[model samples]
Target chain A: MQGKTGSESWQEVWDKSVNGPRALIDCWQEIPCDPCQEACAQGSIVLSSGICAPPALHAETCNGCGKCVAICPGMAIFLVDRSIGSGLARVTVPYEMRDEIRLGGEAWAVDGEGNYLAEGRITRVSGAGRPGRTMLLTIEVPEEWALKVRGVRGRRKLLEEPEEVEAIEAVEDFAFCRCEEIDYSRLREIITQGEFRSLPALRRFSRAGLGYCQGRFCQSILRSQFLADCPEEDREVESFRVRAPVRPVKLSRLGGEDG
Target chain B: MSLPCEQLDLLVIGAGPAGLCAAYEAAAVGCRVTIVDENDKAGGQLSKQIHRFFGSSHHGAGKRGIEIAEELFGDCLKLGVDVRLSSSVLGLFSNGEVMIDAPTQLCLVNPGAVIVATGASEKSLAFPGWTLPGVMGAGAAQTLINIHRILPGSRVLMVGSGNVGLIVSYQLLQAGAEVVGVVDTAGSISGYQVHAGRVRREGIPVYLGHRLLSARGSTGLEEVLVEAIEDGTVKRFEADVLCLAVGMSPLCDLAAMRDCRMVYEDALGGLVPWHGADMRTSQSPVYIAGDASGVEEASVAMEEGRIAGISAAEDLGSLNSGEAAERRAAIAKRLDELRAGPHSRGKLAAKERLYAR
Candidate 1:
């Protein structure tokens, strides 16, 4: 439940990252994963209680090779070195986006929550040649912000306007039932007018649930649209009546006729 | 023509991560297993999972889901399990008659023991343009990109910050699409911090406290509108595709039709068939496993399927009760270990409640 790196193990595990390029793992939850432990060649990471336990990082044994960064499924591991320069630090982040990250290029640095902190330069790009592998982007930032910079912004920008092309037009007023083409407005009108207490009653009146999907797609939508506003005491009883032939069956097949 | 009534030793529904493991386990014990799935493929949702799984090596950890699915199905085939793809089970009658709509013909199967591993369905989010062509489920987009190698769109906006949402957002980035952002109504991320961190470190903003207002598009999806849950401020982003990674509902329509007692567990998504620790439903000869029982990790589903298969085999006299109990104990230990994490504590409690009920 702890978001961000907690202070209980931060001083013991992450202080060595300031000395040299060491793995600064922020994994706090007990996830059943051990790829980082297997990925480390120096025996730096240990999962003492099998795979379900949270991994412990042996900072002194970590050589900052960035292998754990690439193999970590959570992308919680980072390599930081405050001793890279006099006042500059280098942080290696696991990058998976298909952006053309140029070496020695200016990139916007981000913190743990993905907030833009400061501009950093991409100093090295590793695992670029390997396909389907997580590449590491090493960024050079201020020495004080080395531990803070966890990631860098990709080059892709959000689209301001989408191209207009008609693929499927709106036939009805937000139809939840695609097969029956019963609009949400129509269902709401029927539910209010008919005073239907159950979903089967509404289905008989509006034919919303009687579709090829057998209400598989629109059942929840119907429940939320109608019963969501009902009184809490009355809300628990209304459920879609599941009948025989749960899936759509051919009339011929139901009649014991072979196809 | 009369419908042929076929007698089956064991029948497993779905053929996904759960059903395949169930069929494999039962067939390994010499219980003539027949697995049926509506899809043409056997692996179900696992075919779309390109990212590696996050369990121990016993469950094929570090291997991609696609690989694990292939290995499971291959093992089932080696055991001579009959995997009928493109087949649907229409109904489960009280007299142990299961009406199946197979690719070839309509038939009735009288299975001595049945494991309903029907899995879960993606829950849809209702918005103005939610029914649009490009506004699709995140799992559908995953299938398109990972299985079919086709990108759903150039720019995408994902709703929900769960594991599926964050993982699909990362996959969308891998498919060369510009993931504009991931918006969720919750103040904090719902999935593991690692998954959220994985997507966040890619510069994909996790817009926590943002609820989707509507999606606007003329014919297809063109723009998405979100509102800040705290201040009610609106934010618009241009996106050709709007992916809904909302939670899933356990598909138990067949089980419900069979008169199996159902329990409503919010933690397990919705109403699920009441089952015990042995995966046996309230009704005799009916067992439920995987997401059909409760939506949890695929690893847990596979373990549950194995237990169900072993229990069914023992009931069918293919395995002795003592051996079945021993095997189930080992699997139960693994299941407990898989659900020991804080992330899975709610699911574990929900499962125990089902057992207690």
Candidate 2:
């Protein structure tokens, strides 16, 4: 390994944000793991070899179709938009939940490298899932704010800018689920998209909350986010479809020692 | 519950890193070693670790942990160490009687000493929509990726700032998915700064001091709701996946059930069975090594396993006291070195006290 400039290409990849759309994965590492290849519904990536070859990301083939997203275990990829258009590149990331203040609230946006850059108002809030885990709040910042805010600060004792943290604190609206990438804002979109209005019906079009682990981590959190948004309605799951495989099975279990 | 009545040979349980180490040590000197474990596989957590371990060469460093486990499995087989899997040792009877779940009729094993090496469990977070489909544990994420050769999710929101969380997040990036971001409840990154820095430099953000408030998306997880608090106030962010690396509590139930002397130490990651440098426990005849005693990394666990097994062999009269002492002194020095780095210091201290007893 060379220095930080070790391989100019590695740095270029990061600078260009050529890093994949998931977290913890490097399509660049020349190893072998192809689930990402199989995960892509649109054939955007390839894992041709056995499980040792690193996945190949084909730019033109990528439809921004989140199939690879659902299958990637590392969560290392992201749909980054370095192209600043209209002074702002809205990188529609996969957001899971919110803190409160449904209509539109303030958030201290952070860039991909954990730096605080700008302020923004919540633009859109969507909620879905059988139980409704996150109320995805799409905050609209200046076009430049797009790249500046890649992430949001989470549940630590925020000692910086006390007054601002307090303002958001008093707001109380959503939740975050580190799975399936669905939130209230997203759920609402799925419901309204004529993508099957009801919870179970929505399963066909959007596959809300349907993934490998089968929704164990974000189930309760989403329920509260749903009730928080709906309010006057009954706080029940209210007909959400329960996907199977709550516990992931080992390949050995699947093959049953037959292999 | 340990060795009583006639002094027997080496007694080992759980057959993972710690138990396997003890078995090998006892077998090296031909000390009738008997190993029992609840799982059919004896490698324990080693089978699940897909990545190369971080440490020096002596401790099997640079070798992928799974490979190390495979090697250990092979050694134990060749040594003729008695390993009974799916054989749950029901109790630690007063006179060395251990009830077990075996392939044949009910059985019992009485040995001169024992080694405990049960590992740790994945910690979970409380969040709305957390129970929705698509959500899983960080370990589960790794299991899906490295073992099953599958991707857990394309977009992920990882929680926890521990080494596992950070390292896994990095691995996730390697797997080619969008790491929505990392959400840690602590003010600072809990894992190695180097691990965190690598990913941070890669353009992933770490949301320290944040909590997962709730999550949405009906059939599965579509969004992640997170909030940060300062001066008793909260701020929020939303992301796709919710990976929690909060912390792990040591698995001490089996040891605890035996009524062995146990103590709680924050540095050790929770309560653990009492042991000493040689890996001997308060019960004298029983020895324990690795995370089961407390939550430490893999390197220390393996070294500790070696120490305990050697000591168990000597106790079984297989190895002379001088020989056991010589072997242990060497392994302990290496173990101490592995535990010397900044990351291992506090944990090493807590684990050292187990040996002190």
- Give the proportion of true interface contacts each model preserves, from 0 to 1: 0.50, 0.11
lDDT of 1 by residue, A1-259 (tens): 2212333444544567666788878787888888888888988788777667777777777788888888777778888887666788888888766667889898878887666777888989988978657789998888777767777876455333323233333333676688799887777787666467666677777888687877767876776676664445544443466767777777777664334
Candidate 1 local lDDT, B1-357, one digit each (tens) = 566799988999999999999898899989999999998888878888877788877887767788889999999999999999999998899888998888867889999999999999888866677778789889889989988899999989999999999999999988888898999999998988888877876668888998887778888888887777787667778889999998888999888888898888878878899998889899988999999999998899899999999999999999999999999999999999899888888889999988997
TM-score of each: 0.87, 0.57
Interface RMSD of 1: 5.7
List the global CA lDDT of all models.
Answer: 0.82, 0.59
Residue B203 Cα positional deviation in candidate 1, in Å, after optimal superposition: 2.3
Model 1 misses residue A176 by how many Å?
4.1
Every candidate's DockQ is 0.36, 0.06
TM-score, predicted candidate 1 vs. hidden true structure: 0.87
- For model 2, how big is the CA root-mean-square deviation? 18.8
Q: Largest lDDT belongs to which candidate?
A: 1
Chain B TM-score for all candidates, comma-separated = 0.97, 0.87
| Tens digits of per-residue lDDT for model 2, B267-307 | 77656777777777777677778887777777677878888
RMSD of each: 4.6, 18.8
